[model samples]
Target: MKTPTSPIVAPVALLTSAVLLTSAALLTACSSMGGTSQKFDQASVPESVRVPAGHKVAWETTGRGLITYECRDKANAPGMVEWVFVGPQADLWDRAGRKVGTYYGPPATWEAMDGSKVTATQLAVAPAGEGNLPYQLVKANPAMGSGAMQGVTYIQRVALKGGVAPAMACTMAGKGQRQTVGYQADYIFWKS
Candidate 1:
């Protein structure tokens, strides 16, 4: 014995299944493209610079910019000259190649396109290599204005490339001279 099926019921069921399948496919694609479920590996990172447990990555961006250094007298060492870090000026971009924000300051601030911003204190650092800046972990202060930076607890700077101070002599004659060097790094934001 066969029960007759309603024409409307059959089409509705098929449409619902198709929508579900499309959603699932989209989710899978997002994850593969560095979505929320993407895991950040820290196995090769020094223990000192690794993010603490109980936190997960909330955002990730590639920062490409210039780091300025100034030739000045060495602190506490009169007559000795050295390059001192001035600050950084950089643009942040997401994995999708969209420009999202800026990072600049003597206070190390990260600002989002939505006007949300955060300043951080360095927690630890580990050497990356010669001629490269060290990998770093920073503790973020409470975000101001509440957007992308809200609830961010930590920030890790990794995959460093070329931010070291200029190698030219910081002699007395070169005092106060400023040099800007190019750099690129991945900044991973974490939340508890």
Candidate 2:
């Protein structure tokens, strides 16, 4: 026969167990939201990854990954936006086996070394009735029958194992025409 206090102890134990289980569940949910596999945020991005002018990027992943990015502005021009991959330059050797000229390497493969990845693409936009601007500038010589050129569009994609929050910007390329814009995106991934 158990004492009255024994019954009380059993109930207290059951309640404690329930609370611990609930706390564990909550922690798991929060971790999923804050993992590295999630999208990127301006506050979270490193200054080194920002897009530079006249550079095209391509991001890829072998197993799984996620990336978040933003651009100031993107407008279309006359020519198609040319995304390119280049190789390194060869160095000329002097008679003394000295190095000369620049030794450039092939275009870098935008791959994540840590089994993760992210990428962005820019597009073009025109004014009221100007129409869709070309993604690339065909010819920029007024003497050659060209008026003005525009910029390309902006695109960014983030892939992660859990969650992500990414942002990007867009703008027009012209005197007093460029305007900065902001963007946001979310993505998720799961394994079998």
Candidate 3:
């Protein structure tokens, strides 16, 4: 004979399981929302591209998009041609996978959704690996408009993939041609 409480016991157990699963998911979401919770080991980064002492991570983003290259006459080489980098056009996303801003330019710029933006000067670069763009460090110019990008001091480009110039022949016939290659990199912003 079945006890009166047996059906109640099964429903209670199912409810408890559902609550536990929801709690775990919420915890995971909360952890990822704090973008800086993703570890950035300074020691692993080349010193040339590392942020200096006294600066802390202000924002971390993953940039994904295209880098345009043009086939042009090699600088100072009268008859030789080569693929030259034009600029990058990329969307920057936060750790939680939200689109936060954009990176583009002849003057490399990072602009946030709130209208604040910054232009940076390249400070240094180190080899990332074969077929990958080099890691870079840049000093941030004073941000304009005062939102998410305001007060940023430096930016580091790491975890590079692709972005190199096209491997095709840059001959006289190909001169003036342009091509875009896809790339992804992590941009870590720092504040003093």
Model 1: lDDT equals 0.92
lDDT of 3 by residue, 1-79 (tens): 9657776898999999999999999998888687346567777789899898999988889999999999999999999
What residue runs in model 2 are displaced by over 4 Å at the alpha carbon? 1-5, 36-192
Q: For residue 53, give model 3's deviation from the true position in Å.
A: 0.7
- Report the error of model 1 at residue 7, Å: 23
lDDT of 1 by residue, 117-178 (tens): 99999989999999999999999999999799999999999989999998887899999999
Order of all candidates by TM-score, from best down to worst? 3, 1, 2
**How far does residue 176 in candidate 3 sit from its true spot (Å)?**
0.9
Which TM-score value belongs to model 3? Answer: 0.85
**Winning candidate number (TM-score):** 3
- lDDT per prediction? 0.92, 0.28, 0.92
Residue-wise C-alpha lDDT for candidate 2, range 83-185, written one tens digit per residue: 2222212222222233321212322112112322222222222121122111111111111111111121122222212212222222233222222222212
Q: Which stretches of candidate 1 lie over 4 Å from their true place?
A: 1-38
lDDT of 3 at 72: 93
Once all C-alphas are superposed, what RMSD does model 1 give against the true structure?
A: 4.4
